[model samples]
Target: MSSSPQTGSEPVTAPSTTSLTLAIIVSCELMLMLDGTITNVALPMIGDGLGFTPAGLSWVTNAFLLAFGGLLLLGGRAGDILGRRRVFLVGIGLFTAASLLAGLAQTPWQLVVARAAQGAGAALAGPSTLALLTTSFTGEHRTKALGVYSSVTASAMTLGLILGGVITTLASWRWVLLINVPIGVLVLLLAPRHVAESPRHGGRFDLAGALTSAIGVVAVVYALVRTADHGWADPTTLVTLVAGAALLAGFVLVERRAAQPIMPLRLLAERTRAVGFAIMLLVPMVTMSFQFLVIQFLQLVLDLSPLQAGLAFLPMAAGLLVTSRTANGLLGRFGTKPTAAAGLLLLTAAAAWSATISTATTYLGGILGPMLLIGLALGLVIVPINVAIMSTVDPQDAGAASGVLQTTMMTGAALGIAVLSAIYAATVGSTSAVLVGDDAVALGMRHGFVASTVIAALALAVTLAGYAVRERQSSHTK
Candidate 1:
């Protein structure tokens, strides 16, 4: 490597060691990302095996999402205070053990509990990878490492759909959870040998901030998820929403006073990072909603096998991988604002087109085209969005910023699914209607797609407006 100093303040390591570190981090991240959706394809089988009622079945996914999203800020702060490597190992071990329990679960409740444990572990481990990257590599090495990280994240999600299908098809839904055990074990073994311990800040853990924020988010997510079974105006839903909002407000107050807040308030005040966070929250909402609805449409409406439904996403993944470089080029040449705007516009169009799918719609002419567009849109926007989120933040707050971004992503996914499910339910008239006919289900899916289109259009508008403001500010400063 060249003699130029690395971006991080840490001392440089041997190239071979650096390579190993990257491998370990990327693999761990892939595992984490995969779990977010792998269970989706397996949900039907899992529900059948556990004899879950329709309402209870959603917890299989929602449990993990709520825990993971709610605790991310605390986890990132833990890495900053207690050391990233230690937290990472702890997280992997917890997650691995939880996976085993989930695989062996005898009841729906057991599986849901195990899934929540896995999410908690994931929250601890996920942010550490970014923290490790910030402190480990420098120069061209850092760029390459980050690029690989982003690509793996984008691809792993779709890969989960495929992997979930294969396992659930040939073997059992239990294998979907079981597969993670070995991967987690392998990562745990390899991590200590390759990854260096992060330097710990002597700051306090900010337990008050951690607890309040986590609980607040969990409550909000719980309320949202319940809306599928109970309408938004239900007494329990209203109470939970009010409680969640109050807790979150209290969290903000706690953070403002706490010496070592899990999330630094100052980070959110930055214009570019704030905008990035908003976009990150909204984009994932659309993508996750799309994935959830489309997969169901393929399997339920078209009556495709699990394997076929999983394999259907291959084109989308391929398109995303192919377009990633072009996205990076666009970011370099055209800038974050315009490139992101264009990408979101494409995504909006894709969402609109997807809304047109019906029970009679064929894979070739309807689904495949939208999937390709979704992939391309993902490639064109994600990296630049990351750039905007982190570019202006202080180096010392990297962990916190990363934590916030990740938290938003997970929360957005959970919220989107819940909201979309509600829309799906409304369009279908009732749960009874959903089970009555495929036509009702198809109509519900279409409604969900239209809602996602609205979300994408809003994101596109945000990108355009935020960048315009940024440009105006730059000119004024000049």
Candidate 2:
């Protein structure tokens, strides 16, 4: 890892970055990822609080992602135009205030609105967190800083399940949302004193670029979700899908024309960046599909409780944490392509192994082994992909690059759940457990897991191409 750079700013020095500052950065990033999925576990309690229906429960999560994913490019632009530190503080303030409002919400809309507000804050600050670290350290030290940040983001979603389970179990569901207030306030206080303000890029706002990107993403996700209630052929669903695609295509054209695009076209055009984006998209696609399928296997087939269902994932989470620490050294020692390929290999193997699972199999022998491999391997893949995404980016466009990274991730999960869940439901022929026999449900889940394994293999193929092209290029350069 490289030491901190002397950028004529003493406060930006390595020594000035206290343990407190690191804690703040890590906490903030952790909360950002945590909020992305934490609400899933607390949905029952949230329903009780706000009187949500079974279908309405999903709105809590979708609301956040819609606003979060939609405005992410714009949020990154906001940080660039306004000031990273200033925008960060504003996001934290907004997030903390929204957390309070969400906790106190008496109606469904109030909670949904507050959650969307939180997502807006997340979109604003999430990009800047990485951008801030970019300016904070140089070379090797920068890599380590990024490694720490990357691990937290990768594992935070898993950690959220634990936090939400405990918080919702021990306290009221309101505590789930309220917990962010203290942590965010603490981070807000520590951020300014230690973190230096990056110089603002004085440029005109790319309004068309931002709207097209955000609207395009939301349209896609909303359409994907609509497939649950309306069949894939529904007119509303068709309109959303077409308009979303057209707007996204328009976004690409707008980026080429604009002087400063919300998404820099050149970044995506690079082979490495393109592969990284595809990895981001496909990894979540497979993982979310697996999650949807496996929960049914655990509860319907194996007869696990809601809490036990969540707990069944311990091996996956453990493997993820253990492997996240080792990824950096692997990437530092090996180039990005090899590292990513290994990760995709692990992921593919894990999912394919899961296809062997059946109703009579034991948890330890049947499930735990493959899940650990998936977690450990997934942990390894994230940093290499992040390295590739950030490496190709111009230093000036770091926030935009990071926003695009997140947008792909958010969109992928939504898409995965939609397509894979649809396949599962159609195959299973029943939505509710009481109506459908457990054996039939298990058969449907097996198909979904098998399909997910195939998706992972496709990702592996992409990584293999990455390996071949990158190595051939390296030899040519040498």
What are the lDDT scores of the predictions, listed in order? 0.79, 0.73
Once fitted onto the true fold, the runs of candidate 2 whose alpha carbons sit more than 4 angstroms away are: 1-15, 44-57, 105-110, 292-307, 355-362, 424-444, 469-478
Instruction: Estimate the overall C-alpha local distance difference test score of candidate 2.
Output: 0.73
Candidate 1 lDDT, 70-143, residue by residue in tens: 88998898877777778888999999999999999998789999999999999999889877876676555655
How many steric overlaps does candidate 1 have?
Answer: 0
Clashing pairs in 1: none
TM-score of each candidate? 0.92, 0.87
For model 1 the local lDDT of residue 410 reads 89
Q: How many clashes does each candidate structure show, in the order listed? A: 0, 4
Alpha-carbon RMSD, candidate 1: 4.1
Q: Which stretches of candidate 1 lie over 4 Å from their true place?
A: 1-16, 53-55, 426-436, 469-478
Cα displacement (angstroms), candidate 1, residue 278, comes to 0.6
- Cα deviation at 335, candidate 1, in Å, is 1.1
